[model samples]
Target: MAALEGRGLRKQFGGVVALNGIDLDIDTDQVVGIVGPNGSGKTTLFNVVTGVHPATAGTVSWQGQDITNIGAHRIARKRLVRTFQQAMSFPGLTVDENVRIAWEQGRRGGSRWASPAMILDFVGLAPLGRAIAGSLPFGSLRRLGLAVALGVSPELLLLDEPGAGLN
Candidate 1:
């Protein structure tokens, strides 16, 4: 069985249809990317697949189980995680604190292969580990969010736009 699968997935927002009957099958070790023009249902697809938004129709199967319409937290527990284009960080927390929070809230075992410091370093935010999250610029915040997601040790990582605002 595939690690993740989506069939007949569709998402509609009032008058517009974001996704229309999409099907996907991904193996445990395979990497897949979704690309399209702005507002082309790419983010919406991830949103539905990761349970950030409910699918108007269709199903998402993960690890051989139907996981459509599940909450984001529940899906995250299964090691299927996502990061948005926006900086979804704790504004009042420090960069280091943000990484720590994600490591703590992550799955039963957030692979100790790398520490919080290492993850921050990998995302190029190590120097700002002590900086306040709210005071950072947009690009820095985006990196912080990515570092947090990496701390989760997700089996499936969906990044909305990792390079959207980078220079």
Candidate 2:
């Protein structure tokens, strides 16, 4: 069975339809990218599948289990994570501290998960761990957003416009 499936997914915000008759099946260990121009349902699709918005019709499933209409936090708890088109971080905090907060949110058990330092290192932001998140350049902020997403170590990571703001 596919790791993720969406069938006839539809999302309507009041009068406008964001997604109509969307269908997709993604197997495990595969990397797929969603591409489209602005206002195209790319982010909307992610939002629907990840429970950021309640679908007006159809369903979404993870590993054959129905997850349509589930809340975003609930979806994350199921090991399905997502990143946003805009930078998502505690701009007032240090880069390391921002990642640490995400780690705490995503860690599932008593055992220590990947350290914030390790994640920052992986994202090439280790050198700036102590710097203020708000002070970093746009490209670095994007990377930091990715690092924060990695803190969860989600089974399925959905990136929204990963390169949107990069130089």
- Tell me the tens digit of each residue's lDDT in model 2 across 1-167: 78999999999998999999999998769999877788999999999999999999998999879999989988878878889988878889999999888788777632135588989998899999999999998889999999888887777889999887777
lDDT for each of the candidates?
0.88, 0.87
What lDDT score goes with residue 164 in model 2?
71
Residue-pair clashes, model 2? 0
Report the lDDT tens digits of candidate 1 across residue range 54-122: 999999999998999988889988989889988889999999999988877664574753578888989
Candidate 2 CA-lDDT value: 0.87
Which ranges of candidate 1 are over 4 A from the true structure?
110-112
Best by lDDT: 1
lDDT accuracy of residue 93 in candidate 2: 98
Model 1 worst lDDT window (10 residues): 105-114
